[model samples]
Target: MQALPKTRTDGRLPLYARLRDQLASRIANGEWSPGDMIPSENRLAEEYGVALATMRMALKQLVDEGLLERRRGTGTFVKQPAFRADLFRFFHVHDVEDPDGPVIPESRILSRQEVDLPPEVKRAFGDDAGGRCLKLERVRLWAGDPLLFEEIYLRLPDFDGLMSLDPKEMGPLLYPVFLQKFGILISSATDELSFGTATQASAKYLELPANSPVAVIERIARNPVGRIIEYRRVHGRPERFRYRVNLGEQHT
Candidate 1:
């Protein structure tokens, strides 16, 4: 194997930290790709002229961050974020006959307009929030019936040209659009689920009775830098919402 380049030490971070950051950057920049096993600890330690313990610490840091994975018999590999897990955990579409089967809901863009930023929406963006933002009202349909009504907000200028795209062209998911169109990748997201009375718009879009109890989900998506890029509030029929969790050993 070729000699691994010594990690650059700019005098700010410790050697192990520098090594960790270098490895993470390589993965983020696609030097090593998803599912590809990385160099073994002994080989990496020998190449970097670092102690095995130091190299192990660096690799462990990346593993803890979910950027790398270590198998008992297999080698360490790059870890791709599991978007499907989150979708199945939160999305409200499921087949009745085949409970484990996948369902791809149809997307409908009810309206797209530039709207005044609400206080809550502004806070979602943190300092990046401004006076104006784009509001998109949409619905997801399963078998021609609405499953979820969503109100999406995006910071202006970042998503300025998004309003012009046809709804059919947007596909069933929005994260891909952020990547393909705006050069933005959703690195992490937080979803808060609660029960609330359906709003008038939700009632109209979701075809629920007036003031029906609905499952509300507030999803905030951020880029790798932790800058909030999208804020969405989704309302779904409480009966249609199913949440499942697989619990393993808990680490306190």
Candidate 2:
């Protein structure tokens, strides 16, 4: 029988709840990515030395939580978030003449490496996250003019080997590369916007004077199972930043 790690799961919880936590942990650890079919109930029950009903109960819990979905006849697969494609829409550049037309800016990766996470960022990743993570510095440009400077951090092991990839091949969009290369699907993100003075590094990248006012955006991105995968901080030229939203009930 495959034993659940005693240290990670609470022993006082019911077996099915423990199983649910174990399965959720596996998904959070990137064991089974979006669209990957998991083992069948009978098979999982056999492997865990549990009854078929117990395994079914655990799986049902996951399905109800939107972490997994059962196919009609095939098997259970990880639930893929439908909003992933539009996650980066806020960062897209637009042409002045065609305001409705969104243009993908050219991306230039300045650096990518493993580094110790800042205290605040490490806290954001939770207590279990290790001290180190992958850090990426990049800039986005439109018509040869810099539009944004970004400092991105990703959880380690989950994003291992990302530093080895060639930046030129990644293009402007990174979520697709993340899914295609790392099997990580960003399901949702929360962006916090504010105004801040540009630091020397950001000023250099954005072609602005040090201490110039800039628009700041801090984003925390999560996977389908709701595990935090990436934390990003972006500095954009204030003049180029725009936020639009429509409120009220929708009618078809």
TM-score, candidate 1, is 0.71
lDDT (Cα, 0-100) at 54 in candidate 2: 95
- TM-score (all chains, Cα) for each model: 0.71, 0.69
Write the residue-wise lDDT of candidate 1 on 73-140 in tens digits.
99999765554424335656667899786566777888999999989899888775878999999898
Top-lDDT candidate index: 2
Q: Runs in model 1 with CA error above 4 Å?
A: 1-63, 67-93, 96-99, 247-252
lDDT of each: 0.79, 0.82
Give per-residue lDDT, candidate 2, residue 99: 72
Give lDDT: candidate 2, residue 166.
Answer: 79
